[model samples]
Target chain A: MLDQAFETLKTYDWGTDRNLLNPIDEAIVASQADPAARRGLEGRLVAVLKTDVTRAAKDFVCRALMILGTADSVPALAALLAEPEQSHMARYALERITAPEAAQAMRDALPKLDGQMKIGVIGSLGARRDVASVPALAALLGDTDTAIARSAALALGAIGTPAAAKALMRTKPTSAEAASAVTDAALDCAEGLLAAGKSVEALAVYKRFAGEDQPKHVRLAATRGMLACAGK
Target chain B: MNPSTRKISRRRFLEGSAAGISAFSIVPRHVLGMGQTPPSEELGGALIGCGGQGPGTVGGMGSGIRMIAFCDVDRRRVENAAKRFGAKDVYTDFRKLLERPDIDVVAIATHPGWHPLTSIAAMEAGKDVLCEKPMSRFIAEGRAVVEAAKRYGRIFQIGTYGRFNASRDPKQILIHKIMASGLLKECQAVHIKRGGLKVAEWSGMVRYEVSDPGDREWDLYCGPAPLRPFHAHRFGGTHRGYWDYEGGGLADMAQHHFDPINWVYAKDATSPVQVEASAPPAHPEACGMWGWVELRYADGLTFVMDSDEWGDRYDRQTERDVRLEDLSPIDQQKIREMPDPEPLVGFAEAVKTRQQPGGHAEAAHRTATLMHLANIAIRTGRKITYDPKKEQILGDAEANRLVNQPMRAPWRVV
Candidate 1:
């Protein structure tokens, strides 16, 4: 039945009709059925996924790749994400995979992304919460994309590492939204660090934020973090 | 020629109906194919406001639309604005320029107070309008302009510019589909905390002139709005302090965020739901300079919007299983490994076939109205029943009166 659906979708000629996801949905399920067929299907999926036009195809491909969860799919996904032609859907699917191999691949790709895509990649890394990607994620605190830097801070919090907290403190947001995101991300990272028995590190971060000279609200949050650290 | 123009030129222009160049473009490819060779560089547009947001609109638009003319009530702003963009035409009065018929498009980037009047005037003069968002200063004015477009058959676009991938941005699409699908058990409560800029009269350096009593065009400036003292920054072009040109932040960001819940979940306009303002009007209160406003749709879905509030409680992961790191390289490579379709461009293509344009005007209107009423709720600090069908506020006579202000005569919108 899955094969039949895939055959139907592949033949449907989605040349102009982009709204319907039924065809791609079937393809993903079909691709997921067997590993032996995965390699061939992966190439086809990669083509549709890269065009940034095939929404359903991308969805199916992403889901199928996640099912495959092998080392082979990693490089292709990374390369597609790097290109302008990559669909947001494909990038989104890649972000969802949790295989350790997938994490390692992401860790390797961190140095190459600069400016927008770098921020995007960092954000994806943070969401995946791959602890191994911490050093690279930590380095992004000083990234030029304040949104990326802000996301990095939050990603660190979500990852819950002391290093993530330390890096979040160094980020400066240019806009109010960026500032708020950075502060919140830092606070979460700080709390995570404190929970991980890095009280001194958390305290320093809190002190910097809590200082009267710092951004008033960030400073206030830092003070609160310090008080929380003191067990008051 | 610019890319858009060039893109249009390549298409074949049949006699009546023309094929669109791309789903993303508003112009039909056939029309472009029939036209003479396009311009060499950026396609220029005119801006009427020449104020705070006016210049920014031109800047944000980038090469998409060039600034060819600058028109403002004040001579100084018109000159200054024109200079910034190297705009060749400067008009103290917008009427003269609007009559010229040379400008391709006109952006009505004026104060909320002047939006309805200026936009209607520009539209009547047969120009496509990229009017600023929220679409109207008063509720009735918005309705009037919507009618005007129908009568005139003009391509009027609102500037509510939000990044809505409602069909593909899984989180957004999922929520809309869920709400539309009725799968959420029940929408217990929706608390939307929006922290953004308050539309101050002259908060920025952009300035406007006081209405000269003798100037006939002063009547045009005051079109459809109740006559008030010549304050600099009342609605938008003011230089003094903030004034009630519109309903403050309530009219600004609150209108935006409030619309999502109301539009997503069908709600009634009529029937009063109690409303209470958190802070006193006209005074800077706490860190939350903006106040908390709550409106209960007739469907029992309570929409809460707080301006100057802190933090988003709704996690992206919670909504759609998408994490921040989900966008990473290795994992992302995993994505290229998968396949999905484009949403907006798809819809843009759909529009050519005479189908809906992503979210249609009705959808936009529903949301815009929701936002507008929330402003009324905040300003009056009284539970105001809204009648969506009649497009009027039911009880609270004062609030109802405030719903549509007295328009400046002769230059009326309708």
Candidate 2:
């Protein structure tokens, strides 16, 4: 019955025949409340993803995996993150996968992806707060692709470890895009540090932004951030 | 048409029952394995707005049912969405889309100005509505839509999910403490986090040319907004920049950031008694950046929109509101015993069960009120007084004009 239900996946569309997809939809909803069923769904989805199928069919399976996916499903989803057609849906699942391995997958795929796909992977790293990807992400700071470098700067801020903060601070932003992304991230890093109660570390990041030479908005943010840190 | 007084035919309730019969084809909830018996019927939804945040809002509701109809002024957008979402019915007018009796739910993700009017119309047509935020462009209009939803007994949700999608943010926890502890009588600037100011202003800053204004349905697109020649900037993403259609960023971000404050204060049934802003003078035709604004409830609780400048100390105020060291054991235990915020139940589930979604109409309206009031305060450059019960701007003639704006020919906010 479960196998039969998975077969309906091939014809699934966003706003399509509900009665046709009921059994499969039930399984997806049911899996959310039961751990065993979640793992079972994950296993079956991974298997289905591995099979040769229409890209749309695979996209359907990936959506289900967003709620039920485990580390076992990450590799299959990761492989699709660079394929232009499937990359968006793949990244959507991986971004919410809640597994470290999903973060690792994006990091591993970074070198091979380009344009939006590459930028999407870098962004997923930041969203996941993959601290371990900081060094690799830092390298993209100097990349000729301004969008890629900006994505890296923001990702490092999201990672928000002292090391990530240091990397962002060390880089001399070359373009307007890079500068904006770095400033946004710097504040985020300072915020992350302050939230963790490492006021000294937070202040260190804020100080770089507080100088008169800094842009007015960044300077204003840094000055306020410094007060927030000192108060703590 | 005075939208406030527009009557729903008794036939709609009859249609509601008729809709019930065909609605059972919904995805069976039994699959989720919760203890409750699963409904065999699925809810069918329709999209009334096909541009900007419309698609994403529909997408985020997750898949349980399908939206069979798609509507937009832009034919290209409507058709593209129809292909992408498997929508069978497409139209340029929402009234035409509402003719589908099979549509059990409607997602009105149109511009902010249209939220109240579209939602009221959908409810009158016996459809549950999930409207995008800034429930109305003005306070009085929002109140009318809320009344319409109540009168029609329709399930209505606003697009902002911040209040419902509660998480364990430290600031939220502290705010909850202040609420549960009843220490808010003297509270001022007692809540704060990234408000009103982005460190780096991010805008498209792209020059928008109409390309060929006559080629698009410009008149219909401007529905209820003042009659004006089409400018691409006045369309999609840049609509927030103009006061003719929306209240700018404050209105746009109101539900996202202010809903929790409303939830804590239970401010839905009422609104701020006073709204004051210290921003530079605002533009008559467009919106600009605002400085800090204070939304003061009748009870002395002030919701401060913090500025970027240093020494605002809004965070310090929140900290001072509840320090664990300062609290007695009994008080601390009271804080501890206060229940954690429940996770937001899904909207699809809410529709199946005939209950409210996390971002229900009342809360969304009250939160949206804050943004509208701020805009009024900034525009008038004075501390404006508001009477929540009257739903009117108090004693300020010019400000009151904005409280209930007159729509152009062939449209009314009633």
TM-score of each: 0.46, 0.55
Q: Taking the tens digit of each residue's C-alpha lDDT, what string does model 2 give over A1-232? A: 6667677766544334324544664666444346788687788888878877767567667656664666888999988977776786687578667668888888889889888778777876775668789999999998888888988887787677888888888999899657766776776677667666677998888888788887543554565566666662
Best by TM-score: 2
Residues A173-227 of candidate 1 have per-residue lDDT tens digits of 6665456556656655665565555778878777766766654334434554565
Please give the lDDT score at residue A138 for candidate 1: 71
User: Distance (Å) between predicted and true CA of B27, model 2?
Assistant: 14
Scored by Cα lDDT, where does model 2 land? 0.68
- Tens digits of lDDT, candidate 1, B1-414: 011221121111110112221233355546655334345323447888877778775543324455678888766778888898877788877767777656656777776767766665565555556666556666766764553332222335555534343344555543444344433333444545545636332232222234434432453455433233353334343312232354445555544554444433433123224444453332210012335555555444555555544233222111122222324465445444444323432222232332223333334455556556665554444567766555667665445644554332223332
Q: List the residue pairs that clash in candidate 2.
A: A29-B32, A30-B31, A30-B32, B2-B414, B3-B414, B4-B414, B24-B41, B25-B42, B26-B41, B26-B42
lDDT (C-alpha) at residue B340 in model 2: 70
Model 1 bad stretches (over 4 Å): A1-232, B1-37, B40-44, B59-66, B165-168, B181-186, B197-223, B226-244, B256-276, B279-290, B308-365
Which lDDT values do the candidates have, in the order given?
0.51, 0.68
lDDT of 2 by residue, B262-379 (tens): 7765565578898887765454456666666777788666777765642343442342243444456776677777777565555676676655566767667778888888888877
**Cα miss at B403, model 1 (Å)?**
1.7
The stretch of ten residues in a row with the least summed lDDT in candidate 1 chain A is: A11-20
Error of 1 at A199 (Å): 78
- Alpha carbon lDDT at B332, candidate 2: 67
Candidate 2 displacement at residue A100 in angstroms: 69
